[model samples]
Target: MKRLPLEGIRVADLTMVWAGPFATKILAEMGAEVIKVESPQAWDLVRTLIPMPGVEEFWNCSYYFNDYNRDKKSVTLHLADPRGRELFLRLVERSDVVIENYRADVLDKLGLGYEVLRERKRDIILVSMAGFGKTGPEREYVGYGPIIEQMAGLASLTGYGDDGVPYKTGISYGDPVAGAAAAGAVALALIRRQRTGEGAFIDLAQREVMATLIGEAFVRASLRGEVPPHRGNRDERYAPQGVYRCFGEDRWVAISVRSDEEWRRLAQAIGRPDLASLTLPERKARHDELDRAIEAWTEQIRPQVAAQVLQAVGVPAAPVIDTEAIHDDPNLVAREFWVTLPHPRMKPWRQPRSPWRLAEANPTPRRHAPLFGEHNTEILGGLLGLSQEEIAELEAAGIVGRAPVDARPGG
Candidate 1:
C-alpha cells in the first residue's frame, strides 16, 4: 500500500450539514485526520433528521449522518464557553487546516475567525464555505442547496419548455459540487503554503460555485441575447436527444444522437430505417414525433435491455438508473463504486465509495463515523497533553461531552 496524499495533515472540521461534511469526507478519504467538532447545544441536525423509531442512541444511529461523516473522529464542545474556546484554540495549534460552513458572520461573531486560528498556528489554512462569501452584501442571508440553485440561475434553466417555470433538482445538488471545490481549494492552499510559508483564508461561496457549472449559459446570455428557455431533458445542440419510457413502470432510457451517423444507427436499431435519412433540422422539428416512435419501440423492452441494444449498435444510450437500481447497476458494481463499512449502532450497509480514483494511493474508508464526542479523551488528553483530571473538569462544565446536552430526538 502507498501513503495517502494527506497522511500527516490534521483538519479541525467545524462543519455540519452536507457541504462542509462532504468536503471533510473527501479530505478524510485522502488520509487526513479529520476531527469533527460540534457544539453540545447545537449538534448536527442530520443525526436526528431521520431517527430510527425506538433507538435510544438515535443521534449516533442516523445513516444520513454516518454516510458522510465516516472515517472521522467526533468531539463535542460549546464554543460560546470560554473553556471550550481555549480548548479549540489548543486543537488548532496542532492542526494544519480548519474548515467550516457556517453563515458568513457566524465564525467572526464567535471570535474564532481566520486571524485567530492563524495566531494559534501560523501556517493554518481556513476554508470558509458560506452560502454567500464573507464580505458580500448578501453574506447575512442564510440558505441551503435549493436556495443556492435558484439564486445561482440553475433553476431558471431547468424546466419543461412549455411551463416557463423553474424547477429545483431532486437532490441537494449544490452541496456536493461546492464540497468537491472546497476539497480542491484545500489542496491548492496547501500547495501555495509549501512555497510561500504563509496561511490562507479561503472564502468559497456556495452560490458562486453552483453558478460555475453553467458558464456556457452566461456566455450565451452575454454574446447572443439568449435567455435559455427550458428544454426539459432536450439538449440545444443534439436533435434527437431525450429520455424515453421503457417497459417497466417508471423505467426509462436516455438516448442522444450526436451526429447523423448515430441517428442512423438508432433509427435502424429501432426498426425505423426509413427515418434514418432525415436531416438534423428535420429531426429537431419532428422531435415529438420521433420521441413517440422511439418510445413505442422502447416501451416493449426493459430499460437496461433497450440501453444495451442501442449501445451495441453504436448509439449513445443509457438507462436512467433510479435511486434504488443505481446501487445494483452492473457498470457501477464492476468498478466497485460502493463499499460496506461496519457501524457500531447500525447494520453494515453499502455506501458510495469516493469517486476519486487515485490509482496509486487507492483510498478506502477506514472506520465508521465516531460516536458523538468519542474522541474527546484521545484528542484532548492524548494529543493536546491535557491531564485526565483537566478533561473531567471540561466535561463536567458542559464544555465537552459524549452526547449532545440539548439533544432533541426526531425534532
Candidate 2:
C-alpha cells in the first residue's frame, strides 16, 4: 500500500457535529491518528440527532455519523473535570494538533485555553472554528448550520425565481464548506510549523468562508451597486443554462450552452433549424420557453441519454446524482470513490472514499471509527504513562469512560 500523506501526525479532535468531524474525517482518511475527544455529559449531537426505530445503539449504528467519522479513535473525557482536563493536557502535549469547533468561549470557560495547552506543549497547532470567530461583534450569537446560513448572507442568495423568500439547500451546506476550509488550514499550518517550529493559532469563521463563495456578487455590489436576482439556475453569462427533467422519479440533467457554436450545435441536435441563428440576447430573453422546449424532448428520455445526447452535441450536461444514485454512478464506481467496511453494530454500506486523489500518496480508509473511548487505556495508560490504578480512579471519578452513562440505546 502507498503510504498516506499524514501518516505520522496525531490530532486531538475536540469538535462535535459536522464541521469539525468532517475535517477530522478527511485527516483520518489521509492517515492521521485522530483522537476524537468528546464530553461524557454532552456527546456529539450528531450521535443522537436522528433515532432509528427498531435498531439498538443507533448512535454507533448511524450511517450518517459513521460515514463521516471513519478512520479515527474515540475517547470520552469530561474536560470540565479537573482530572479530565489534566489528562487531556497530557494528550495535547503528545499531539501535533488540537482542533475544536466549540463556541469561542467554551475552552476558556473550561480553563483549557490555547495558552494553557501551549504551556504544556510549546509547539502545538490549534485550530478553532467558531461561527463568527473568537473576536467580533457577532461572536456571542449561538448558531447551528441553518442559522449560519442565514447569518452568512448565503440564504438570501438562494430562492425560486417566483418567490422573494430565501431557501436553503437540501443539506447543511455551510457545515461541509467550513469543514473543507478548516482541513486546508490544517495543511497550511503544518507546513508553516515545518519552517518556524512554532505553534500557530487558526481562527476560522464559518460565515466568512461562506461569504467568500459570493465574491462576484460582492464585486457587483461594490462597483455596480446591485444585488443579484435569483436566475433560477440560469447563468448570467450564458444564454441558456438550466436543469431539464428526464424520465424517472425526479431525474434531471443540468445543461449549459457556453458559446454560440455550442448553441448552434444544440439547436441542430434538437432539430430546431429556425432557432439556430438566434443571437445570445434573443435566446437569453426566451430562456424559459427554451427550457420548456428542452424538457419536452427530455421528459421521456432517460437522464443518461439526455446527458450523453447534449454532451455529444457539444453542450455541457450532467445528470444530477443524488445520494442513493451516487453509489451506483459508473464513473464514480470505476474511479473507486466508494468503499464498503463491515461493522459489528451496523450493516455494511457504501461509504465515500476521500476525493483527494494524491496519485503518489493514494490515501485509503484504514478502519471504522473507534467505539466510544476505545483507546482510553492505550492513550492514557501506555502513551501518557499513567498507572492502571490512577486510570481506574479517573474512571471512578467519571473522568474517563468507554461510553457515556446516559447512552441508552438511541431509539
Best by TM-score: 1
The root-mean-square deviation over C-alpha atoms between each candidate and the true structure, in angstroms, is 1.3, 1.7
Off by over 4 Å in 1: none
**What are the Cα lDDT values of the candidates?**
0.91, 0.85
Q: Highest lDDT, which number?
A: 1
Instruction: Estimate, for each residue in 291-351, the C-alpha lDDT of model 2 and write its tens digit.
Output: 8878888898998898898888778999988879888988888999888887877778788
Name the lDDT value of residue 315 in candidate 1: 93
Write candidate 1's Cα lDDT for 294-390 as tens digits. 9999999999899989999899899898889989988899999989998888889888887777878888888998899999889988998889999
